[model samples]
Target: MRTWYEGAIRGFGMLVLLSGVGLAGATAARAASLDPAMLPKIQAATFEVVQAKPTGDTLSYERPLPLELLPYQERTDKYYSIGTAFAIGHNRYVTAGHVLLAGEASLWGPPELRDAAGRVYPIGKIEKFSLGKDFVVFTLAQPPAGDAALEVDASPALNQVVYAVGNALGTGVVIRDGLYTSDTPEQENGAWKWMRFSAAASPGNSGGPLLDKDGKLIGVVLMKSANENLNYALPIHEVLDAPSGNAEMESRIAYQLDLFDTVENSQLKARFALPVGLGDFYREFQSRIDANSDAQLKALLARESANLFPSGAGSARLLHQQTQLDGFPTLIVRGSDGEWRRAGGQAQRFALDGNGYVATGAVANNGLVRLRRPDGVAAATFYGDAKSRMDLLARTGMFQRAVAGEKVKITSLGKPVRESTHLDRWRRPWHVAVWPLPYANALVMAYSLPVPDGSVMLVRFTPPAHEHDTMLDLAEISSFVHVTYQGTLAQWKDFLGNPALQPATLKGIRIDFDYDHRFSYTSPRVAFSYPSTLQAVKPDNLLWLGFRFFLDGGKPVWDVGDVNVWKDTASDDHNNVNVQRYVAPPPGLDDDLSGRWRKLAEREYPYNGVARYENDLMKINAVVAPAAAGSQPSTVLYTAFYGTAGTQPQADMKGKLDLLTKDMRVTEH
Candidate 1:
């Protein structure tokens, strides 16, 4: 069934082999103090092997382990190959079996021979022996070096002094003295057997020669264990004493080489599976975290914990953990059996309270506070995937906008304390900010109360739109969200789970526009532009408008607008305030959008026939158009904002949309 070439390839692939080029390039200079007289022989034995990885940069191979670390050893970049080799044959050479067998496939399709000068010769013939036997024999199609071949011995005396030479983990060739100890077979993979010795070995040391007292080849050095002085070598005796009739070695080498190609191909696939964009973002985030002070970071963490409510049956808690595995933070839970497992998804919503003793959030029908400890221990029962918890929390409504210069309070068993400050919400329900905090640890439990209250507090209020003061270098672009609210502050105290807040005090505040909002809407009359490539995919007129009104310190309350305002107002005072228009329909889709303007107020209407204030309004024409082809062609338009009689006069805004036509250029408008 299998051809001779395949068999040779298989055999060659099973054992590691090094190239003479890498060995020759090793840092022999570092060993200069040992003996210059022996330098030529060491150099002569050195070789370099160039291994081309499927996706990463090629790795360079070396011979004899360098006495000192080499550039390759300290290289952080991914390499394709590992070490070097030496001249063992006219075209034939000796190298470690492990190098060839490192992966599922071999570097050489079949056994290959390399000379001290760097020429390569494919093995025309090859022979393989058992693990204890260690050595393989091969005939090269051509000679790589003209140097005379070294003799091989079938057996060498135990505890005899020997010089093992080969690329030791890509280091240059150098001699080290050690005693031949013992031979041990590996249990997991039987193909490789250990040649125990006192000499040290590195990654590039594979496929090197172990010479006896007379400089005759005895075995091929392979690896060393960190825990012990044991080293491994393949016995050269087997190659010199194989049965004359057995001749499948070369074929095996060829098959093995082919396997190397298969392995490299799989490596390429794995390399590309990672998301590069996300990786870049992560780097930026890490930089920010490193720059922040510890104290500020602690407060930021507490706020983040506040937004993420508890889920399932558990009091909410914020916990943190670090991992050996790289990348973003992950949550894990220890099972009842004491095994750490990823926490369930349902538990992620909760927050830590009462010194993190209980987890609490929006609980289901069953009353229970589910939780997981930072060390992955299950503090309470869980029923969801912990991995997706952060994702869900990041997408929360609280992070949609920033609440600045506002009075916020929280209270638990203690009195409520309030403060006036600015708060920026993340795009997700929960926010993870890099603030300054002294604690090096990750988890904490905190509670919110009415302004100035130290007790637990639940807030029930909605966010509002704040006017941009254009004269003060403030312009509200489509990319930013502005919020302003004149409302009473809500207060709640001494409660767990979800507490309720009642209107307590009126406080006026304005939040600066942040360039984080994701939604955008343009008047019908404005024109839009995009990159030429994207023009075909995204046309125009994709508008989505949403607004909210909440108590000074509250959650984002989406609108039923003007209707709610009028309903809450006293009937006698409603006429004076022109509240009748609160129930008006939303603005139309076309240029005349007065009705839509009326709906922006958070008011509600129960009956349809009511003629809300019909006489007081101005109309503006708006349109959106596509961009033409050009390097930086753009569409520009003027938009107007207006409100009812009693409201403040809205400002006029101008905008431009740009579409780049060139390839590989940044997109800007």
Candidate 2:
């Protein structure tokens, strides 16, 4: 959203960086080899911080794992190496706060320690923690027998030899020597200096010990300089002198909602009693961070209150504006003038087997994709079927390749980890789902709305912490999602019969179909019923219903604006009839159609007219029906610019128009 905004709810994003790729908050410097006697102790004291084995494998992988992912064995390992931690005292261990926090809310199981021989030990109490400093001191549930703790060196001479040791790249413990470089102030408040070393530390080295020439702890390696081999490590004294039973988490947080680039910065400061188990500490940490996020969001909302939606002058203008008939969700943006404008993405299409295709594009931070049902898939199965929905989505080439650094073949997406439903501003129900990207520290979220033939979907990948904020954004945006259902009469019958398969919005809609006898559709705003003889909806007949959003009594609303029915082109010659609604002519512009409707609407009785424009390509015909804004009607010149279209009595079009309009009703409000 902005250069300053990391957009991960708060600073937990910092953890993803510290423990990913070849990143390290460490530095390099001169090194002198340690005495041979220290080798065994060094290895024994360090441990790989990993997630304990889960009860079961939840993911279904492609058979004969993708060749590009050469070492799929590690990808399937029960233990997931997160970072490094080392013995600092009898039963006590130290690691980066970020490393330990990764397991918070993770499905990967609790954090534990893996020794040189792969034996595992559960982690115990979190004795101390510092978010800003990025270090943690804790204990093991069961310490290795007779294992020695590393010696501490509070201050090591600059330019002296040092070693950065840990489970570098999850390949097991490794020792890399370098020089003790400069001392730089920690970025947030610079309350203390961090020992910068030139050690070749990598992602897995975080929480590992940076040792002096004598094998004593110089610092706890945390992160690497953005552009250099020099890395950062927390001084050992910071941990040694800290209160044993407290957590001091203070970090500078910057944030911005996805809609705009406006940013707000705040320092999150919270202190709570610790020396407690990891679960208890995490609960307190998350609670405080959530509060901080609320404050930041409130501040941003307050600053923009005068220009926000539905309450500002800009909102008034948008509400008064005419409906955009193009059915696709759009982003509501505030321009520099503080005027609200709709931002819609360009349509992009991808082909699939049969006549199936996917049309999608980006709307600001969100990617919007729309797909029509494939011929082989049943309409019943496509509705409210999570597995089939995601599978169809994956076929659109959205998410099937690499997660983190490993590439795996994806024949199927399996199922979402979480699934739920949300009702939009229009009262339409939408499907929401979240799928975890194994090892990626991220999630793929899908917001889907079912249409007659297919669905309109919103997809995005977010850092785990961002889910709450993202969901709120998606929920509001769903109201702006434009959709028009179109499908074969056969598909519609099967689809309309299942209320449980419909979103709440569709639940209120009723479709009566007496095969080869009668067909009718009724919604809150419109209704039409016709016998098979008037408009025969054979099993293969096609029907289209388009919805549009407009303001009714200054309140935004969405309803049917267009309806079209036609004979199946596959079995018959082109034949169609359509009825469209035009909202009342807004003040100002007086276009020809608006002027015609205004004049016709002035009649005392219901107005009716017909026109024919014949061309070499084809013959066109239309009938106009206009009536007064009924009891609750809107001046919405949508004031009777409405009517019905059906296979008319070819010989008496006028008589047919009168009959059809009598059987149909369209309300502009």
Candidate 3:
């Protein structure tokens, strides 16, 4: 079915005209007018329903215009002509419910109508509206003088010649003649039927009055079927024959508003809060299982189960453990009975057992466990860390491909439904959504909760058939699952007993050097040893001194060590180094420099200042010392070796940095 908005045109092709034989009777009747005597009255009653400053909040009802036509089309302050409304009584006007509801969310003001002479009339309080029937009636705040209401025909007959009068494409109200073809039941609620016609009602003809040969109102034009000339209208008697009491109308309005609010809220939540891509995984897995033979499917499930519940871990004793996952720090705790358990941020805790690791809270399936309901629904939860940024949209698209597989056609079932972020009993925030799978008989629901240290846990539930409502099941499972950490038994053993985990051991490094070229760099407040092959370059502002180093090939390298000694710079009081810089101190000297310098360095640099920065391209180190008793100022010695950001400098390069900063001195100029 197509809406009346011009934008609702779905394709670029011109409208295909149906054979004239089917519409011959109506075409001949057009010359005789519905009624020559009532023509003037019908024209006067019909007005162009133009909404100036159309509300922007509502979704666009029109189809995207072709790129070529867009440039020549005039930009209008007015939205599409919302079909048409005609005076039914002294000041009462009637139109389609959809036309008004489309703008109800962001309507600028009261809707207004324009007559053939270009006179505008404002609409007043809506007298009645019914979403079920797609009809609305309101009073004109200022009725046009001598504008009599159109008479309503309680009955409209099929095959009878009729006239459709309304603004066609916003040009003006034009009466089009056609024959009443047949009636079809409304799709949503089949309690009533719609009158089909062969009239050429365009985008602006919706809500216009459908008149019998006598010029009496028979129905209201609403929409047309795509690929055919068949149009539809609501019987006029449904509105005129119904009671017009304010209480009944108000009740109907309230019902429609409540329903609309629910739908809008659901759509908004889905757009922003729900986790994406889970549906694709579940759908694909289901399709794979369905296509395989029963024996093969069982084998597949067994393999998945094994991967999810590996047996190598068995059970292990707890020892001192230090590990980070999903941005959260975790600890290994030993129970009185000697069994080990992991616990830390976000209620992350799991028992070490041979029966497969079970979470203290929500179940953290090991990515392979296939969950099945008595109803044949299968579910799986995949755990992954967002350690490196991953595009959610791209991930979801990949899942779509998996589900579509080799031959099945996939159709989107509207948009995904999003629910508000709900906190589980463990107090973890989870984003959830229920998505209809492209499959004819299945639905996939999923929720994702955050883990510490930049990680995410996703759980997906897929029902066996689309008929099943898995929403409640998803909610129950998600609420019960707890965050958990899993690892091999060896990893746990090393975590608990390894002395290398100690802070001092982790930060310690040793260096020895044999210098090829050595010279002292002396500034006003400090002096440092650097390679004589390095060229000293002074900054234009004299804020610091730079030593340019070269590779063996004599190509100039930009990674240079800089020294700055200034009495007034705030950083002078405390050794300051950019986080990107690497620093390394001699084994025992880590705490030897008055303890103050060591404390500051450790607090500001990674690896507690032992190494300020190290990457594949280079490694850097710095040393700072305060001046004696009333000397000039504190001094800083900095050095770097060629390397990349993700790797460490070679042993030879490391030794150079140690020797370069060795013998660094702070003395008064």
- In order of appearance, the predictions have TM-scores of 0.31, 0.78, 0.37
The deviation in Å at residue 82 for candidate 3 is 3.1
Model 2, C-alpha of 284: deviation from truth (Å): 4.2
Candidate achieving higher lDDT, 1 or 2: 2
lDDT of each: 0.30, 0.68, 0.42
Q: Considering every candidate listed, which one attains the maximal TM-score? A: 2
Q: 8-117 in candidate 1: lDDT tens per residue?
A: 22322243233222223334442323345555665665554444323421211122223234444433322333444455656455444334333212222223333344
Name the candidate, 1 or 2, with the larger TM-score value. 2
Model 2, residue 501: displacement in angstroms?
A: 5.3
TM-score head-to-head 1 vs 3, winner: 3
Per-residue CA lDDT of model 2 for 374-450, tens digit only, reads 87887777775878877766665555566446655565567788999888867776889998766455678889887
User: Which has the higher lDDT value, candidate number 1 or candidate number 3?
Assistant: 3
Model 2 score (lDDT): 0.68
* Root-mean-square deviation per candidate: 25.6, 5.8, 24.2
